[model samples]
Target: MSIGETPARPRKKKKHTGRNIILSVVALIVIAGLVAGGYLWNLGRTFDSNSSKITDAFPAEETRPEVKEESKDAINILLLGTDTREVRSDETEEDEFATLPGGGRSDTMMLVHIPSDRKNVFVTSIMRDTWLDIPGVGTAKINRAFASGGVPKAVETLEGLFGIRINHVASIDFEGFKGMTDAVGGVTINNPIAFRPVHNKSYYFPEGEQKLNGEEALAFVRERKAFTGAGGSDYRRVKNQQLFVKAILGQILSKETLTSPAKIQGIVQEMAPYVAVDESLDATKVAGIASSMLNIRSSDMEFFTLPNNGPGRSADGQSIVIPDMDTIEKFGEALQRDTVDQFVASTDLSK
Candidate 1:
């Protein structure tokens, strides 16, 4: 207490305020960011592992066109579906490669066009048996491109035929197809005619609206031959496919699915194994597209099938779907010019 002695500095009082809370928040945010980063990194690795990159997929002229990213210019995705099962044997890896031709035949193929407005998506299914010119390979069945050259060949064939750029490609197994249907809680399709598919006589779908679970849905889509109505044609099958797709969109955009990000992620994880995507279809690309298109509802999507003549036998004795080149050319032009709206308005044959 000596007068000359400096009063002991009062220890700075520990303040309980926003700053303390802010510091704690900042620490939490940093930790959370690190964890999220790690999770995303791991997810990316998983996606990359399940996919095969196509270096020669696109021809030289394809990379030329310039369009604003995520604009109304339209983004095109080539979706190839195959009934390929993952059968592994004790055979060496080299033998495994030998067993797969092109990349295994894509039983179903479609071009998914997402216009810039983000209001709706356009899906056009291509008949798998269409005979067409495969770039650097001889003319053959469209599905044969995968068997001859893998996904790259398939992509190249389609891109060459269509005269447009395919931004990404996703090849999916039948299990993935079935799994996705189930993940979306199954799809409800309106059957134009009641028919039991020859592929599976065990089940029958009555005409009109039908709510189908995964197995039933797959059967519904695959029943082209058993359809006695309209000759049970391939085009008929395409219609079934389109109908099922619309139902899927409805299910995915339903409040039940969109409200739960964890559920969506879990579904995607389950689908990953049965899917093989292009190198460009990484997590960042997918996330960016999904975030931008969040406003799109199932009602906004439209589906169609590429124009094709009825089945015919080729000179080589292969059954094939002949191309309706005139209509297809118009479609290609509309697609190239990003005027798919016009194409859909006038040339959507499936309607």
Candidate 2:
């Protein structure tokens, strides 16, 4: 046979190589499973078993004594920051400066609303000194509700004051706040003025964007006198708090911080332990809430203190914040409908 003819003698049948195809199929399946697992895990953690009980406190017209699908969608959470300087279980002697039971007060109170649609989250900070009705306790300082009966009383006070249903409550102690700030490395704030803290004598930051560590961040938020200038007071301080929150949020949502697993884990661990959620919430659930809020940009979140005419002495002789009822009612109406524009319009900064 000719050499060419012999070579052409049927090339040995090439066996179909299925190995690569099989490996590819296996890889796809594994990826799909991981994606599905992650989704399920997140969903399962979004709402805890006791969600109903905790949410029952806030009664929507449609949700009260009845079941409604729409009512389930909108959620309002009360964020309370207590001053527990003296109530430490490990402490033998009460520090004169401790705020909790013996000395401390509620330094900050914020109401966070996460709409059912998950479009954006709205946060409103209530000045701790705002005197309002405390349900069964009658009228009193808002911060005292925590000391009188812990979170339950505080929730009652908020429900009475705002006439809105607060679905959940989350309390984070001071140490947790510090740790969270540290975990995120630090937060940046725009300091338009410079001053010093009366209590700590720490140097205040100048007007500009400043990176703040845990301690400095805490001081910044709590520094009323410095931010208010000669007339520095809680009103200005609350505004600054709102600004600080926005800055912290900006830092947190930045690509550099959110994408880093190690940093994220550190933040989660440090924050989770110090947080006390209503019986309904846990770390996983809170994480889901945070995830849902990822879409709310720093600019989208607007902050305003309750409009007040001035500080006045109550019949009991104690100082009290006199809220502009007309404006406050309008703000409440806006909150009920989840409209930021209405709320912002009702606020006249000129006061």
Candidate 3:
């Protein structure tokens, strides 16, 4: 609801390690606030040179959407959590959560809409398994759009589908999630259901309000398969991911967290190293956005999934989500008209 909810810039990624994907969301909020608070310069000049940049990620003229902007206006960003395929043999110990699909797959994607007044933030969680067309490539799972073309391709794919202009893009790895989470001293969540986490059966949580440290939170979100009898609900996991992000934002928004420069810088330091952001998301951009959003509060936030009918087997037997086009178009229209509040109020959020 309040400012410091997420990084002001847009970001993207592959392979939805539910918790890791949300880390991108966390980084945008944490780092952007640091820049606004003057902690950025104190961190030194290495900040700019240190972060990896995604090349040619902006959409071309022909494919671009018409957007209106003032010095202060609404911003649409894509936060991506990716599974980078590089095999890091240098590390003495393996990061258990980092092990994922071979190709760079944005395991999780979130499109955040920040209104002009910045009173409230509306978020849409995109299910990776949703069947859709990729620009230059044919129809496939939406997550695969990033595999070969990287950030640019993924941005184009979303632009094509949503018909909205993306102002910034940030991509982060799984390891960054844990580091950032721990830096904030862990998060407390109202666990909706209790089950064994997907990757590690050893870690289990009861259905109740609980506090989870970095590692436990990561496993908490990844547990889609254990909750339901049929097992593995991508949509269900997405809800968990959304709640986790909101909870983290709430943690940072408190007076104690915001006043503490060390905690903010610590998150930025741990998160910045693993983030790959588009050219538009510099300290200047982050600071400009954060300064205007200092009044935001947790109650001003809203979360929902994208519209999809149900799941079906592809021709080749691959499982995929069936998107509801009529519903998607209306949502896109709301984004373009800057009437997200009305749209969210009138329609049902994706299940």
Candidate 4:
């Protein structure tokens, strides 16, 4: 250790330190870019996917009646869940449960109203078996609208049924629903009964609060027989579906999911393929709606089934849900005024 040796200069240490700092900065930049890019990409994708394709689906400017004061607020959308069993022919059997070879009836029909004020989201679930006008096809089951003429006809039928203007349509298949549930690491459902379906022989889930996987979650919502164990029926099934939607929305908004890159990507990818939007639904509209929806919470969402009692034997001896005209009219008025309180006040939830 001679003094002229310059204390054996720590060149190696300096070089290592420099390399480590550079690597650390690069990693941070990459991660930040990914997070930012994912957020922007997802926002853009949702906007594009949800825009309406059919501008004429609504009346033209000339056709719309002119008023002293025009309403610039609020938008209404139709959310459809189709029961198609086949999406891809080559996919494994397990993944093919939700995909159907051809288009089938819609298992779920929901009309979502997002007011211009962005205060809350109103959801009304229509029964699949509800008898309604099928446009050119005469009277038929409401679910048949989608199968007969696709989304446009479905929208038309719904518009006619409810007497409200629908601005957009978002239709997703069964597989997409399952994929979303799995991507979010499953959802928690409060089971009100302890019953099992014949198909799910080994899938015995006890009644109570339980976490559900993709398959189990699907079965939970689709199980009419199980919900009936405690005197359940289609009405009970509808209630469960509403609860499931709320649970899903809550899960999606949690910080655990919003901040996870891998989970977000998985969800977006799964949702992209099976979702179809009207041609008019573009990225801008979707982004605007999503930005507005950020403030909405599970508490802000309201779900209710159309008022109806059990099915009755018609003149042909076929069972059909007899719609109570008075109840339906009350529901329609509440919707037209965008007042859930008005609707729920007059209606009975215990039916």
RMSD list, candidates in order? 8.7, 7.9, 14.9, 9.3
Cα lDDT of candidate 2 equals: 0.64
Model 2 TM-score on a 0 to 1 scale: 0.74
* TM-score attained by model 3: 0.80
Q: Candidate 3 or 4, higher TM-score? A: 3
Candidate 1 lDDT, 150-251, residue by residue in tens:
666777787777777788877666566576677777777878778886756899888898778778877776556765543246678778877877787787
Writing each residue's lDDT as its tens digit, candidate 2 over 1-351 gives: 566565343434222236657778899999976865575454344333222223333333442222234444667888766555544353222112213322334677899877677776778777665677765567776766765665566766666565567777766665666777898988878776676776768556777878889888777776665444322477777777778778877777778876675676566666665555666666466666776776777777666666676677778887667767777677666656666555575567444
Kindly provide the TM-score of model 1 when superposed on the true structure, using C-alpha atoms.
0.75
What is the clash count for each candidate, in the order shown?
Answer: 5, 6, 29, 19
lDDT of 4 by residue, 1-351 (tens): 576676455887699779999999999999987877677677567535532243334433442322211223557788776566543454333223322123433567788877667877777787766767778888766656655665666777766665667777777666676888999999998877676764567777677999888888777676665554322456677777788888888888788987886786677776766776666666666656777777777788778777776566556664456666678777665556665555776678555
- Which candidate comes out best when scored by lDDT? 3
Query: Runs in model 1 with CA error above 4 Å?
Result: 1-73, 85-104, 228-233
* Candidate 2 residue-wise lDDT at 113: 74
Extract clashing residue pairs from model 2. 98-104, 99-103, 99-104, 100-104, 191-207, 228-232
Candidate 3 displacement at residue 245 in angstroms: 0.7
The lDDT, on a scale of 0 to 1, for candidate 1 is 0.70
